[model samples]
Target: MLQRVRLAVFLFVLGGFLPSVQADEVWEFVDADGVVHIGNAAPPASRGLVWLSQTPSARGGSGSAKGKEREVSALRLPGYEAAKPHLEAAALSQSLEPALVIAVAAAESAFNVEAVSRKGALGLMQVMPATAERYGVAGRILPDGKHAAMEPKVNAQIGSRYLADLLRMFDGDKELALAAYNAGEGAVLRYGRRIPPYPETQQYVDRVMRFYRALIR
Candidate 1:
C-alpha cells in the first residue's frame, strides 16, 4: 500500500515532466492480490501489455522519414513544441514578446502544464489563482471536480497579460517586471520600484532572463 501511494505521488508530482505525446497513455498492473499499480511504463509483471505505441512518430507519423525528422526536431525543449502555439497566442494578445512569455513559463514551471507550486501557483507560467482572477481568467473546474490551471492557453494568456501589465507598471523595465512577477508588484513597489532583495525573486529574474536570451538567440 505504501509502495502504491509512493508511485501515485511520484506520477502526480512528475507527470508534467513526461513528453506531451506520451503523457496520456498511462499503464496499470494488478498484483496477485488485485491491488492495482500504475505508471507511465508497464511493470515487468504485465509484460507485453502496451498502452502506447513504441514508435516516437506514432502520433506525428506520416509514412515518411522526413515526417519523423520533423517530430524529432520539434522537441527542442521538453514541452516547447506542444506549448508554442499557446505561448505565441498569449504573447500576441498582450502585446508581449513570445520569447519573454516562453522564458517566464520555462523558468516558472519548465513548461509543465500540470505544475503546481508550493505557494498555490499553477500551470505553465505558475499563475497564482489571485493573479489569474485579477487578469479576469478564473480557475477552471476539471472533470474530476477540482479547480485546475493546467490548460496551457488559458494559463499562458493570464500569465502573459500579467507580465505585460507588470512591464507597463515598471515602465518597460524587464528586470523589475520579472521580479514583480516572482515576488509580487506590491513587493516591488515596497522596494522602491526595483527588484526586491528576496533571494528567490532575484534568482527567478536571473533564470527567466537567461531563458529569454537563449530563446531570442
Candidate 2:
C-alpha cells in the first residue's frame, strides 16, 4: 500500500511533463551564483540547489492509464515518468477526465512534488493537514517536511478525491469547485454559488478553469 501510494503521487505530479520530439525537453534555472544549470536531474555543480524541469516530457501511462478517457501525453513533467498510474487511477476513481486533473496539477504546482506553499502546505497537491484529514488521509508525515503527507500517491488520491468531492458538492460546477479548492467551499456558498467578489478567489477560479478548459479540448 505504501509503495503503491507513493508511485501514484509521482505519476500525477509528473503527468504534466510530456516529452517532445526534436525539442531539448529541458528546464534551465539560474542560481544565486548567476550560473545556469540544465537537465532533469539535480545538478551538483549548482552548489546543492535543486534544478527543476521547466518543461518535461510525459511518460506512457499504465495499462489502466489508457482508458475511455484520453491521456494527455503532452502534459507529463520531466523525469516524473513513475507517476502515470497514480494519475490514471485517481482520475478514473473520481470519474474525472484525467487530462483535466493533470492540467490543474500542472497549473497548481507544475508537477513539483516537493513544492511547499508560503503557508506550510505539503506534498504534490499542496494539501494542508486539516484538509488532508477532512478527506480521510492517513499516515501523513514524511520524515522530510516537504512530503509531510503519508506518501505522494496517498496525497494525490486524497487531494484528487477532495477535489472530486468539491465538484460534487458544488453540483458539478468546476468553477465553484475550484474556488472551494482555493478559498474553501464555505466561501463560495456564502457568495451564493457565484464567484466571490474577492480578487484572489476569483483569480484562482479563473486560472484553474483556464488551464482546465485548454486540456478538455
RMSD of 2: 11.1
Instruction: State the lDDT of candidate 2 residue by residue for 61-117, as single tens digits.
Output: 222333212234324454245555665578888898776566555544545565555
How many pairs of residues collide in each model?
0, 23
lDDT values of the candidates? Answer: 0.63, 0.53
The alpha-carbon RMSD values of the candidates against the true structure, listed in the order shown, are 11.9, 11.1
Model 2 stretches astray by more than 4 angstroms: 1-76, 143-150
**Per-candidate TM-score against the hidden true structure:** 0.64, 0.61
Checking candidate 1 for backbone clashes, the offending pairs are none
lDDT for 11 in candidate 2 is: 18
